[model samples]
Target: MTTCATELLDKLASRRAIVAVIGLGYVGLPLIRAVAESGLTAIGIDTDPTKIEMLKAGRNYLKHTGGEWIAPLVEAGRLRPTGDFATLAEADVIVICVPTPLTRHMQPDLSYVEATARSIAPHLAPGRLVVLESTTWPGTTTEVLKPILETSGLSCGRDFFVAFSPERADPGNAEYDATGRIPKVIGGDGAEAREAACAFYGLFVERIVPVENAATAEAVKLFENIFRSVNIALVNELKVVYRAMGIDIWQVIEAAKTKPFGFMPFYPGPGLGGHCIPIDPYYLSWKAKEFDVRSQFVELAGEINSAMPRWVVDRLAEALDRSAGTGLSRAHVLVVGIAYKKNVDDTRESPALRLIELLESRGARTSFHDPWAPVIPPTREHAALGGRRSVPLDPATIADYDAVLIVTDHDNVDWSALAEARLVVDTRNRAEREGLAGPRLVKL
Candidate 1:
């Protein structure tokens, strides 16, 4: 190992390393919490002043963070929150947890990652280890981040170190936390960078898996989300076919899962959502085009998942037509659960927004009710839907809508209350799971 790597490794091993985590959103906050909880001094850096102010006041904006847990850490001075990139100069280790979203053309938009890299470049110092926890296509660490940081006259693996450790953050998942419980997959620019990165992560993370290089580590993240996309696409296709054959896709999946060894069950939803499943597969598909290869499977999966909102809307329209003998033009639909998934406030790439848009485009009046998302926040694609508040889920409110459509199956919702509605379209099979069945119910 080089002297820089050796020094970083020593600082990490002795718990003397000043860890700076950038982009203090879902991934960054949890990571910094884990670092501080592990007895390391963690500096939380973000470009968002609101997040900085919230952290400074010991407030938790995210629901999954277990409520104001950062207060004690902030009081103890173990967690320092700031909005300055210049603070990177004081950090022995820096982790970038910025978003890697797609562009309007569905191609990988690395603007956030690029901007973050540029911000860190000027603060680059020898013996400081930089690790990227952002999910992106292969070679981003070497081809994108390393090149940007080297512009500061510091060479990776020699004067400084660089690594890619993809963020596997599952918000609203109470079972596991990514920071200290989940296994971390790390790949470095070189042997020394890899060693230093692994050693640093090994201090907080439970297990560390070092890969061949930065590109391989990047590929691992893409592969994980792509695997989910492909499997979900299979189930989604099966959902359509089985529905045609008068079969319940959820029942088939539940039975197939009984024979544990081979089949891992991937549930069908109205559409794909969340930061990773809806977005990461496209990164690889876009990257494959550069090598003159077409990721037909990945692209096909994207097409199916993307088309799901329309399919659900069509199903709802058909149900409405059958129940009320009137089309969607005169219908006032109540959409249940606007969040991407169950029990989470995150709405990134949520299909429910598209569902609402498609419904309105088809002349149906739409209102939503999500306990988590009381009011829709501004999103890149669904900015027009922002500021819309969640409607009441009471029986009286359910009685008013032409039909109640369950897009997301949040456990907190009173599923039985839908019996009061004249018509109900269930995309998630939530009604069935909740023992709710009647002539008014339609399962898509």
Candidate 2:
């Protein structure tokens, strides 16, 4: 099987490949940026009017997605943003980066991917290559997406090429560029499809490795994320155990890393978040049940990780009582950070949302301040709870809250002022790193 990079490099120089991208998410947008910068004729498709409009107007939706990179491509007419699936018929290559988010029940939700495939199926054509970049279960490309894509009477591998290349995009990391990331995996339903897909990706990516099959590529992505899920769970479990012994888990891990051999450090926090570590392992767990294999480590980690929000609430309750001699109820609890992870604005599966809900349920008035996120959107779980609103992040306002719970650690947020806060519950060690001496605060 030829790698996507080789196939792309072979054709992209001739300006022959017409690229179409589905879903303008954190994964899709950067990919389109790469495809455009590679000199490919790129078309970006999205159902979201807001995102589509933003791209068309040369505005970047994501904070890390700068307009400087996309504006030039759009101006040159090499890149386009469209809502029409009819344009897919004109594509030589199509990349699907739609989200495969989890259901509220923690089940694999393939609605977005399936819906996007169906939208493109009607326009399926010969000599076209379709690549699935959405991280999903192993059988999804073969069993789920294949059937949907072939519905247009297009026989895959014969009339069109189909492949699965799990996206390795790490949002908000400056170290890895869209095209500079090394070694993307590609697997196809057949050799021709595999070669074509690889050649297509080779145009943009620096390295591409063609795997044996789609299942291999899918499993590779699963293992990559599941490793983090399990390790973070280990640290989370250790954090809980060490908390009882009054030892900081972060310090313990940092000290362990002092031994240069046999240890890569992972941290503990309120809970898991975003699209990968928190959810990817569960897809394997679900698949394991079908094979009658119990994934105990994965399940146990999910359980412990899930319980972290409540544990955080307990810590916050204790902090409030210790600081004010009263319960958490009726306390003006302010969340210092709300994003799913530090330094990024993504809140996909953030446990901070759950902490806010738990706090409010206990009769405590809750508010949040995230400079990156001036406004919050309504979530499926918190829609009736007034969705999300903004709060003041000023110094005077910092003293107004009874206790400040730091869920995320953005670099821009004033750490000095936060350390001086009257009462603080540091989940991410943001306050501790500030070296605040007086009014020592609690840490999770």
How does model 2 fare in lDDT? 0.83
C-alpha RMSD for every candidate: 1.1, 2.4
Give the Cα RMSD of candidate 1: 1.1
lDDT by residue (33-62, candidate 1, tens digit) is 998988999999988899898988999888
Candidate 2 local lDDT, 1-444, one digit each (tens): 334445544565687889999998888898888888888889999998889888878899899667877777888988899998899988888999988878888889999999988998999876678889998988888899889989989777667778999888777677874654757899988777777777777777889899998888999999899888889889999999999998988889889999988899999999998878888898889888889999898899899899999999988888788777768997888897778876777777778788888998898998888877656666776665445666877776678788888898888887777754778888888787888644548888
Candidate 1's C-alpha runs over 4 A off are none
Query: How well does candidate 1 match the true structure in TM-score terms?
Result: 0.98
Give stretches of model 2 more than 4 Å off: 1-13, 385-387
- lDDT of each candidate versus the true structure: 0.88, 0.83
Worst 10 residues of 2 by lDDT: 1-10
Against the hidden reference, what TM-scores do the models get? 0.98, 0.95
